[model samples]
Target: MMEAANCSLRVNRLLLDPKFESYKLSLDPLPCYGVELDTAVAEVKLRDDQYTLDHMRAYGMYNYLHCNPWSPDSVFYVDQLGRVMNINVTLDTALGKPIEVFRFPSDLSSCDRRLCSSIHFTSQDWVTLSDGTGTLYLIHILRNDQSAAGKWELKFNQELGDPFIVLHSVLYTRSEVQIIDALILSIEKDELDVEGSGFHVSLEWISITCSPNDDKYEILKRRNLHGKSVPHYAAIEPDGNSLTIISYKPFRFIADETNQPEEERMEEEEKKGKEVRELFKMTFALPEGAGRAVLSSGSVEVTLAKREVGNMWAEVIAGDTQGEFVADPAQSAAIAERLMHLTSEDLNPNPDCEKPPCNAQELEECDMSLEDSTTLCRFDGNTTKATHVVNLGGNQFLFSLEAAPELMPCFSLRHDVDALMWQPVSSQGDNLWDHAATFNALGYVQASKQDKKFFTCAPNFSYAALCECVRRIFIYRQPTPVSTVLYNRKEGRHVGQVAKQQVASLESSDPILGFQASNERLFVLTTKKLFVIRVNTAG
Candidate 1:
């Protein structure tokens, strides 16, 4: 167990864009799109054009798309303050007003104020607008008082994503202001710092550090620091990767007044008057493949105190390439088991059989052997075949044939069926088809336990279907309804489901049109003039 005490903490923050491109934010493209705070009523669609400026009373903001004569497809809009801006281009806006032609800033052009690739208000006070040009602005909108107006300043180089702001809180104090971001927020501080300056995987060499001045306690009222109720400060690492700041007021403490000299009793008593700093030592093994599992080659060890005693607040920074660590239990165990299975030069039948200390050379050699071994089947595009090496009928009749392409052609699978109903394979329609490329990219196939081949497709000449795997295939069907079955090879069962219809264009009833599907919910592509279904699946 490593004790964390008197340690200097180095902090790092990681912000990632989780790709929330799908949810069509019902942000109205009309001039009066915002909610009227006094009335709580939102304006829907108002005509946005040059003629709109004529009725200045009706024009609250310009949120409509403008088509330039030269660039017919380019969308332009004037903001609430009547500053012209481009659509789909992230720009710095003041309360939905373009910064370029802001009412207050007459000297700066829209392009001069620095443009953001994406801009959205996290809150009235906390705004996260990014330019993706390596610059991020965290504008703190102060109160609307005469002194506080136009007092916004950038937090400076905080490469934050739009969604991650939900984890952050801006702390204002008499002395200092700080922003703490956490996936888990602690109302009451209870965390213990792990030992050492840097994270370690082994407990044999451990370093622990603790501080008496707790962050939670420091933020508490000045009166709270005067009594026995003052919070005990501790920092603990929950694992190799998380740092938890903990605060607690202990119920009781063991006093060791037996051996202290009478001369130093007063000094010792004064020290005892202060809050006790709780600390602990932690030990855990780094599970194999932990680092590799998440596409990260770094790991960290965090030690957390028992939760019953204190409230814990934690801040977690993800691993980078510099400090790559692996700790996934399953992956780690599999790796160790593989190592143990390999032949070793210093093999011992006693305690060594259970766990062996392997050298770099031995580990490398073992990895090479495993890498050389091939899977049951490898798809080869050049030959347009799924090369199978499985000895199903033993060595006597080893099945080594590529699936005959004509034996089964995939048309369309049922939305709620177990197998893909196939048809003749041909590139005969306006639709795109590639037998060699399609089959080669197929992910996996299920083997048949029964006499029936684990594949089937719908009979449709209008659509083309090519089997990627024995169970999975590409069914190119147009016109509206479509259905397909995705078989799980390991379970030897087919998943029946309808493909979602893609909204290619918008209807005349629905004026708004755009494409959104990064988050995997609803994918919609639209045009103001027409509605087209790009992807449709009928069950």
Candidate 2:
């Protein structure tokens, strides 16, 4: 159904009250009404509004959220100070105070905002968070209790090798956590530095057990970095589960890193000297439903266990269109047999296909996430002034045009609707990026990165979603959400007709830190409020 653009224009009135136009966000009338403008309009009735987070940082990201294990419609938010809270916006008012959990560390206050990350695993009762120093903390959220030492608000600490080692993309199971970490945070190489820099994935696993008789929790930390073979050419294994990098030069593995005195540790590091690239391997288990699989690393090794192994999957994470999974019928049996044999042994392969080469040379031919913005510029010329590098699909990269803050005020630099652009690049070895042409413009986003990660694109390319720079998120499915919406003076924004795209608006004066769209609902978190809006992005 369509409606009028101005609400003050009554049905009985014959003459137009030209004065009523200024009340509307747009001066012109809409070409279409209701649902067409849903994506753009900001005012929306939601289940919740105010929720407080004390130490949120301006440069911080609290938008990264996860599903609440007990509450399907709600989510958990971990703020910059490492405090976790369960927020349920599915109701007019969440009856419960909503338990908020804090970390044992006395001070996450000094941590750098960039290196902060947290995850509340699905179906798991634990929460893991990371700090700038590469340190990690795994908290049994359910067993929120105090330890013997009054300082740490933990029941017990497992001392996982180094509490300071940073981790990424950790995989979880019933009794264990496969924590994968990167040896190098960012890689930058140039022609002058021929042996170019790269990064390798390493893993460590933690086992936990709980007792019913006493409120006791047991945690086992295993850190073993071992690699039996290194193939100089094996970038990634065929099954797609394991990563094998072959390098001729080999280095000694670090055997022990226990409770050595600080001075002794310093002396050991002094003697061992400059950075040595040890062959390391990190393996990730096949997804949950396949079977029982575990990914282990000191040097890492990931093994997949499947009951029906012959059938292959099209992609790794669903909707990732990087490559097609074309399984060769001929090798299916061999792979299945090998996988079956691996199942019998406890994470041991014939020759552990784990570990990357010693030196992470600029595998100019390698798509290892080891590359940073600099490396991306080296590989793709079109990405020269690109502020961010996002690999949405296989070889396609999406970028937004953003210059210095001073340049933003210039009309030439500002985008009318503010949208992202996509460009496809040749894989591995191609530096012909300058010769590359534009693909197509992504749909408009309401928010200007003002620059932060408040934007994310749907995999299927149906639409792109982002929160505007201020307090509004406009969801548009039309040429634009701005002009297509109706403004009735009486009913406020939605005066004449009902616009229906997934719509949510923050009522708070505080700036939004982060938000995520999942399951037809929008979850937004700001410094002083949390809003869960029931939306319909059903294009």
Best by TM-score: 2
Ten-residue region with minimum lDDT total, candidate 1:
199-208
lDDT of each: 0.24, 0.34
**Residue ranges of candidate 2 with Cα displaced over 4 Å:** 1-66, 69-72, 79-82, 93-98, 110-117, 131-134, 141-452, 456-464, 476-504, 536-539
What does candidate 1's lDDT look like per residue over 106-138, in tens digits?
221233322213333333354333332223344
Relative to the true structure, candidate 1 reaches a TM of: 0.19
TM-score of each: 0.19, 0.36
Q: Output the TM-score of candidate 2.
A: 0.36
Name the runs in model 1 displaced over 4 angstroms: 1-121, 130-136, 140-341, 344-500, 503-539
Per residue, candidate 2 scores C-alpha lDDT tens digits across 1-539 of: 01111111011122112222221122222121111111111111111211111112111233445544234345555554455555444343332343455543645555332333444331234444544334545454453444111121333334333222222222233434232212212111123434522221222333344432354665533332222211111111111122212222221122345633334466668755854332322244455545443433222353454433234555555887663344457677878987884465554445656576645574423233321311121111121112222221212122221111111100010012223332222242322111111111222222223444455433222333567646766443312234455666764655332213343456665566556544445565555555555443434
Clash counts for the predictions, in order? 57, 22
What lDDT would candidate 2 get against the real structure? 0.34
Query: Which ten residues in a row are the worst by lDDT in model 2?
Result: 405-414
